[model samples]
Target: MKIAVLDPDRTQADLITQVLTQAGHVVQTFGSGKDLLGQLRKDACDMLVMDWHVHDVAPVDILRRAKEKLPEGTPMMFITNSSGEDDIVAGKDAGADDYLIKPLRRGELLVRTQAMLRRAYPSQNGAEQLTFGQYTFETRPGRLLMSGVPIEVTHKEFYLALLFFRNIGRPLSRAYIHESVWIRETVVPSRTMDTHVSRVRNKLQLRPENGFRLVPVYSYGYRLEKLGG
Candidate 1:
């Protein structure tokens, strides 16, 4: 999982990054709320750990903005010295998933982070497999199979396909797809997404005969719909 940490204190940020990294997560640290917000504009992370008091922007403000940009239900944690009831209320109201009072304990941080990830991305938490009709995904081995036959896919393609399978029958906006799969905030060209969609369609053989179809949603993005009844 990719995590973004926003802290004005370099030492605390580094400590958080180190702990998360050791646990096999990709961590990016930002020195100010402004920088973190900027990064979020072009990229998305799996989780966000932010200081309650940031140099340029308030933590609640950042949370609000992040919620607007990130996918629905993206987990956010607040690590700060403020422990007042009002502060806690404000954090939750602004959409923070968890709050950790600072002088953060390494063990507590790890545990809370793992818990949040498990809730937000269950597949990452140890679900070994996911199936959609004839297709099956083996998370542990990072393999995809159709009718018990192996299918070759690139790293990006695999993630993209997994996203579609997870949200089968739902229309996913292009922005959502880009952020979820690429984890970048930069504007992705339409053709880039289109090309990948085309590849996934061909590779996965999503068609009526296969009981599925990966179809474009006009101007929005794409949808993976199950065919037949």
Candidate 2:
């Protein structure tokens, strides 16, 4: 995905750029809204990550102008330090699809980015609802529901869960998952996958009642097991 990040804070912009690039997305950073507008006038991006604060012109103005100039469907997210009600409302009014209160969590960012991408680009995955254990995953809609309620899962987390479910009762090596999900050249520490898996397990509501367990197959990999399996 091609992304544009607009933020006067060089450090934050750099951090975002690094994370997105590391995830194998092309990222272009601009220090101000004016620069972003100029670039947009020339070319539109797949997504935009805009900081709430920028010198002179407001981020909202840029969003409004971008909406007018480019396709109305351009995806965008707002990154902000403020969680104030007004700020959130303003961001929404400016056509921001999602809002993240800083400091940003990499997992959260990945999830949200996947969500935006999933929304912006429709999936060809045929399963509308996938059942594993007591939970259900809606692939095309990109939602995870447990006991009839929606549970939040980031894009990568959702993908990880889906992959595991598809291979239920089987041990899937970490190397296989890394290759399937992440950039081949990206050397993510072993612990990173573990952390993401842990998060999925924690949030999945998979239990005795739920009829599922994400079990670690020591020395080999992990498996998604159903009750009595």
For model 1, the superposed segments whose C-alpha errors exceed 4 Å read 127-229
lDDT of 1 at 177: 80
Q: In model 1, what lDDT does residue 92 have? A: 93
Backbone N/Cα/C clashes per model = 5, 2
Cα lDDT computed for each candidate against the true fold: 0.84, 0.79
How well is each residue in 1-229 modelled by candidate 1, as lDDT tens digits?
9999998898988879876875668999999888888999999999999888786897789999999999898999997674566778899999999998867655467768878988998766784677777899886567999999999998778878987887788898887687666653357788888998899999999989989999999889999998798
Per-residue lDDT tens digits of candidate 2, residues 127-168?
468776567888766799877889898977887887788777
Error at 224, model 1, angstroms? 49
Clashing pairs in 1: 42-184, 42-185, 42-186, 43-184, 43-185
* C-alpha RMSD values across all candidates: 14.6, 10.9
Q: Check candidate 2 and list the clashing pairs.
A: 111-154, 111-155
lDDT of residue 210 for candidate 1: 86
